[model samples]
Target: MILDAKQNEKPAKLTIKFNTDKGTIYLEVPCDIPDYGLQESIEKIIEAKCILDNNSNEGLNDLYIVEDKSGNLSIMTLTEYINYRKSIRQDILLLFNHD
Candidate 1:
C-alpha cells in the first residue's frame, strides 16, 4: 500500500502477470473491490485482453497473480500456491513423524 500526500490515504493494488509466446504482460488492478468482485474483474480483464490480442486463453499456461505481503512479493499461479501449501504441510508432517 502506498500512502498519498494527504494523510491516512493508503492505496492498494493487485498486480497480475502472464506470459505469452511473444512476451509477458502485466496489469495493475485496484484492490478496493470485494474479493469476489475482484476475481470477476481480473477474469474479465484477462479474457478481454487475450481476445483483443488474438490469443486463446487455453494456450496461456503461464498466467499468474502477484501478491505483496509485508513488503515481500510473491508471484505464483493458483496451482503453484496450492502445491506450495501441500509441500509445507508435508514438511510439517515429516518433522513430526514418529515410529
Candidate 2:
C-alpha cells in the first residue's frame, strides 16, 4: 500500500492505495493535520480496521493485536501491513520537504 498526503492552502489530504487480487483500492482522508499527526492517524486507521474486522489475528502477526469478538474477520497480510507503514513514513518525509 502507498500512503501520501499533501497540504495546500486548504485542508490536508491523505491518500492510501493498495493492490488486491480484484484490483487496487484507494482511500482519501481529509483533515487539518500537523506533522506529528501522521503516525497517530495511521495507527488509528489500522486499529479501527482491526476493530471493524472484529480483531482478526490471522494475518495481523506483529502489526497489531487481535481480540476476541463476534463477526467475520478480514486480515491484512504481513507484507501489506509493512508496505502500508513504509508508505506512511514516506509521506511524513515528504511533508518535511514541503514548504
Q: Which residue pairs clash in candidate 2?
A: none
Per-model CA lDDT versus the true structure: 0.55, 0.46
User: Model 1, range 31-90, lDDT digits (tens) per residue?
Assistant: 676687566656755663564366445544443444333332243444765675577678
Location of the lowest summed lDDT over 10 successive residues in candidate 2: 65-74
lDDT of 1 at 37: 56
lDDT of 2 by residue, 13-85 (tens): 5656644333333334445445565555556456545444564455433322111133222233447555656
Which regions of candidate 1 deviate over 4 angstroms?
5-8, 52-99
The TM-score values for the models, in the order shown, are: 0.36, 0.28
In candidate 1, how many Å is residue 89 off? 46
